[model samples]
Target: MADSSPSLDPVELGAYFDLIEVTSLLRHAVEQQLREAGELSYVQFQLLARLGDAPSGSHRMTDLADGVVYSRSGLTYQAGLLEKAGLVIRTPSPDDERSTTVTITEAGRERLAAVLPGHIEVVKGLLFEPLSRDDVTALAGLLAPVREHMRATPPRSAAPRRRGKVS
Candidate 1:
């Protein structure tokens, strides 16, 4: 359990709560759009979109998971789904035989192309419609460093299983 003592000042703590709420709202909205448009989950769409956008149209599985903020194990599942759909293929990594690579297929590209317009619209509506130019810039500037730092650590969902009992 967290200590009762507050680590941040009241205003800062409130801001954190606000950020969490806003993020959830935005995520829910995007999920709806994705589900309706292509029956895709956010992570699945993220994988396809990233692969589609990759210069080489492929990325190592671990790299893809990190980039998309998914756990490595979860990414494996999503990748499997994409492969089964004929949207992508998982194969031996040319750079390292021990690792796998995910490459977007024509079908994957087509799927991404199909969903992108709706995705962009949803983003603009939920995230950009109210923000002024300066608001957008300032928000990005404020968040970018924190995002970069967190990117160094894999998310809990994707972290390797820990060998320990819960308290």
Candidate 2:
């Protein structure tokens, strides 16, 4: 029997490989810059950046885990480390009894501020340098729908955890 799986044509295959390589390169550079500038791991920086950007300066931990595409337990551990560093505060959510909220503290903002310049430089050099304004716009236009399609399903973190063996 023939294998029954969809396959990419050469153009699509090349595009997929190029996208993966570029993202990996960009992430590595960004991680290095974040570590050097603020002593933050990539996930910690993402959490702080999200909190800092929120108008209310906070979000429920579940929302954070989904937004960052990180596992819930991993997010919890990272939040705990930030709490110990006095960079963020975790509190019981006023709006949701079962949910915990995380807020970026002043120190978190300072740390984010300290890292923004280097982060921007790294991103610019690695990701945006070769792209023209039109290329950047086209890239976003192309990827936005794909991103939306992927996000149409609930994030993995939003799924209920299985407790028993499957049949």
Query: What TM-score does prediction 1 earn?
Result: 0.87
**lDDT tens per residue, model 2, 1-167:** 99789999999999999999999989998999999999999999999999999998899999999999999899999999999999999999998888999999999999999999999999988888999999999999999999999999988866889889988
Per-residue lDDT of 1-167 in model 1, one digit per residue for the tens?
Answer: 87898489899999999999999999999999988988789999999888888899999998887688777778999999989999999999998997999999998888888888999999999898999999999999999999888777755546667879888
lDDT of 2: 0.94
- Name the top lDDT candidate: 2
lDDT of 1 at 143: 96
Position 55, candidate 2: lDDT: 98
